[model samples]
Target: MDTPCAERSESYIPNAIVGYGYTEMAMQEMDEQGFGSDTPSGARRVSGVSSSRRVDRQTGRAGFGAQFRLRFSRSVMPRTQKGRIAGAVALFASLGLLAGAGYEGQHFLLHDERFVVPGSSAIQIEGNSHLTRAQLLSVFGEDVDRNIFTVSLAQRRTELERLPWVEHATVMRLLPDRLRVSIVERTPVAFVRQGSKIGLVDRTGVLLDMDDDSETASKGAPVQYSFPVVTGVSEDDPASVRSARMKIYLKFASDLDSSKENISSKLSEVDLSNPEDVKALIPDHGTEILVHFGDSDYLDRYRKFEAQLPQWHTQYPKLASADMRYDRQVVLEMQAGASVPTNNTQTAEASDPTPAPIKHAAPRPAAKKTAAPERGRPHTKLAAMGQPHFPDESAPTGKHVISSKPARQ
Candidate 1:
């Protein structure tokens, strides 16, 4: 066993080993790693795996053994291009499996009877006043008996908002077999007359129809509001225009009501056609007198009108309208055709409708039957009926267009 030339037999046995054994350099390297069994220790130890480790002073492990272990670990996992391809393929296969599993799970949720919607009873609706349960259920009618996961919450919300009463709405899945619907209804601020039809409108100018309860129940839709009937806002007008008009109307009402006198309640209707004029019809004696509140200074004008009303009514019993656009002076119009005959009565009747009454109102020449009356003057028919008493309900009984803002005269 110690002989170096042990293979040199009689026939040589056709070189039993295919190639030469470890070279001198390999043997040296192996010996450095404490695995040179071919050296003097070959008969004593089979391999370096079973031998005692020679720990280094610095690393606390055999120097060659530790380096060889580090190198072996690096080589264990393939770094070749082919090996990388195989690893990538395995990663892709794992991802595909996960994706397939997720698809199947979602399909189950979408098709399972447990997740199917039973009926409208399974839906929870809240914050609805004018919106009826049946009307709301119609929006999700297609969802009945279908899996809840298949119902589009966003689509349902969009449909709900399209209703006249719904301002905005939120839809959510309650899991399993139910859905939760939260609605914010539009609040009607005024009664709007658009063309021939009368409907309720919110602050944003959205027209709404009365719900079944309000239409047929004890409380009528119009009975809910005590505010004046609004005119000039119509469906033909753009949303922006309607909104703008409503803004002015709201401001006028709010400012007048701020006094706590509830001065807006004195009149029955408000005309918003001319934003600059903002005319309000107030009951004067037996006639409905038009008062121009103008665009701003609502509270001040209302108070001034209240203070000077009796004086104006006392002088002109058939007062038709008073223009309050002027700060100091007001254009007064008594029912046209009232005779201005006597000097004392004509002077008092022709005075300004504002707080400051014109002093010594000179009498104008009596109109000859042959001559036509001057512009801005009442018709002769009205002048002939001295002290006329026209019955006025103070509410809009028919359609009428208010004149544009009068020119500064």
Candidate 2:
């Protein structure tokens, strides 16, 4: 008997499974089971069962156990071959369009005239006092005419900082053909004498190029620095050591300026050749008087010398030097052949008469006395002028007096 169409449709394999290479195999298995396209209901049922058994046995032996079961479901499989091919082509097309857009964008940025650096006037530079605008243009080089987007900002900034006076530099693109550059300049604190050449130096002892010509020399000569000169530091010295010496020089200069008497105004030169001993020369009465103040207690020693200057000037007309390296005392070195008073005794003798002598309890030994010279003239001596006076307990009446004695010549 012929099978009903509805019954035959239930036994036929769906098109979803045909894409998985099951259409020809299912047809061959059905023909072997004595069933054709016009098969009876009973034969169709037999063919369907036989084909399912053969497929499961082959796939299980081939190690596609789960895949074989998944292939039977229509919803789990790809609907058609044409849909997958179309999707792949669309994916490649979209990627190509994106790459082309990116390339065009890059090209526009590189060649756009609006983004090109217009001229030197378009570049806004600030915070530069030692370096001129023309000098900065030379540093930019070929980047001057290039588009702003193409300019290497980091490279330009590094070149700017390499300048002698620039401590730091920052570069920015202001868009539409403009660039902004700012600099932090190093400030000169003193003039450093390196061999015969003198150059400006900052507080950190970094030598700087004097391009501004702020300090002038003889007619048509190069610029010279007028800042206080610092010596004893050489180019061969280590950077750290030079920096340390600069700090010491600055400290001494500051101390001199902050003194009660403005010694810095009178200071023409400072000798730092000896690190442990700092000497200052003061111009007094058409001659320079050397003042030796040791490394430590500079301000205190300076004040002491200033206080005793008038007294020493009066006593010795040509006071060449006063050494205050000692504590509570200053050694006054007078000019050669300058005559000073022998002692206070001559002054006292001229003003008052001699008093009574002291008496001892027992008979005292005779005090020895040296014979005077043939000329019978008092010999010159060196004396400590500013020694702190303490009351003499041995005296009949205790009193603090200005101590003066003949200095040994």
lDDT for each residue of candidate 2 in 1-409, tens digit (9 for 90 to 100)? 4345444454543333433544566555546666554545233333334333322222212122323221232464347898778878888999999999999999998888889887788889888666777777777768777789988899999999888788999999997889899999898777555544455678877887555332222224543334555556667777788788788878887887784565665654456667788776665555556677888888888777766666556666556566778774355554433444554334323333442121222322332222321221112111111111111111122211222222212
Q: In model 1, which residue pairs have backbone atoms overlapping below 3 Å?
A: 336-382, 337-382, 337-383, 337-384, 338-382, 338-383
Kindly list the per-residue Cα lDDT of model 1 for residues 1-409, writing each as its tens digit. 6243232221121111111322355445544666433433122121333233333333322324321121132465568999988988998999999999999999899888899999888999888766667778899889899889878888898999898788899999888899999999887776665443445788887877654354224344323455565777778889999899999988998898897888776665677888888887776544566677889998888777667677666555556667677776566655444432234234443443322233333344443232332332222121111112234322212221111122222
lDDT (Cα) of model 2: 0.58
Candidate topping TM-score? 1
Q: Any runs in candidate 1 off by more than 4 Å, and if so which?
A: 1-77, 80-86, 195-197, 212-223, 284-287, 336-409
Worst 10 residues of 1 by lDDT: 10-19
lDDT of candidates 1 onward, in order: 0.61, 0.58
Q: Give one clash count per candidate, in the order shown.
A: 6, 4
What candidate 2 gets wrong by more than 4 Å, as runs, is 1-96, 194-198, 212-227, 257-263, 331-409
What TM-score fits each model? 0.64, 0.55
Of candidate 2, the 10-residue stretch with the lowest lDDT total is: 380-389
Model 2: pairs clashing at backbone N, Cα or C within 3 Å: 381-407, 381-408, 382-407, 382-408
Q: State in Å the error of residue 348, model 1.
A: 3.7
